[model samples]
Target: MSNPLPFLKNETPVNWFWVDVSTQNLRVMKAAHETVRYPISTALNGLGERRNSACTPRGWHQVRAKIGAGLPANAILRGRRWTGDCYDASRDPDENGHQDWILGRILWLSGMESGFNRGGYCDTFRRYIYIHG
Candidate 1:
């Protein structure tokens, strides 16, 4: 958190994003300090970097890539590809409609620290930890 002010600059020298699991908040920040915050839910399992932990890794991360930029809101996606369908609010989720989807905008994250959130079995990218949906 040292020098956290740099993350607020309207003209950022670096591109980065932050996920605060404690508060369930995602901060889309970095060079366009056009920062935006959104509510998020982390790992269905818990917190950790180990693969299959189903946990959200800790430490610094970057938006390695973006997906579904133009997809409609609540558009259902399967395995990162649009399922050619959108969520029907009238239908219940138990009806097998867009229960857990990585739809809308997806920002794949890669770890910035070695042996922690990155590298070996703790690699976030390998772990498929992302700021998605």
Candidate 2:
């Protein structure tokens, strides 16, 4: 609820991504000022650090990897690999029936805090938690 910038005083003030699970919002902060904001959807199971919980982990995180660079919009990615299929809503609404495809780009996140979301079963990267659109 307060400015998170103070917590990052020791860190560089280049750019930071903040996700508020309560409001389902993601904000891009530059020098303590929000440059962009977007609506985000978190796991239905809510927040947790355990694996297979289908929950969003809380704690500091950094972008570990950037996926689907230069790829077309709506590109279907399965297992983090491009399937060469683009989603066309007009064709069939349930074309990808029973399957969830990671569309667009993926910002793979790695938790920075140890024993919270970084190591063991609480590992966010191992849990495959990503910010994708």
Candidate 3:
């Protein structure tokens, strides 16, 4: 596998959250700690940092904030603000609906690297990308 991002220069990330687009998994790694991997579902639109693409952004990112704390499961959120309403998937599941169904908890991400995942149309923060549950 050739270098995906040449800017990385073969350097290893100390503590990072990596989302594998192909496997639909997110790997969490911390220094001196066991690596953990979680099954995740990315956008069906595919990968890109461009705004409004509905695609998952690439490159370095940091968890800017944690939302939906102390909130009940299936709580719906709009514009990162809780709508105070919950959508029960069991009752009225998406099942191929137009809505993205951003429910439960959300971990807002901000890009650390400029000109890639950050800045202009490539900005993930501006794109409203989140690790949502």
lDDT of 1 by residue, 40-112 (tens): 8887777888977878788767677787888997887777788888876574665755466666767788887
Candidate 2 residue-wise lDDT, 27-129, digit = tens: 9999889999999888888889999999989988988999999989799887787889887665444555545558978989998877888899899999888
Model 3 lowest lDDT segment of ten: 89-98
* Superposed model 2: Cα runs more than 4 Å off: 1-9, 91-99
Error of 3 at 53 (Å): 2.0
- Global lDDT scores for all candidate models: 0.74, 0.84, 0.83
Clashing pairs in 2: none
Best by TM-score: 2
Per-residue lDDT, model 1, residue 81, is 81
Report, for all candidates in order, the number of backbone clashes: 1, 0, 0
lDDT of model number 3 = 0.83
In model 2, the Cα lDDT at residue 103 comes to: 90
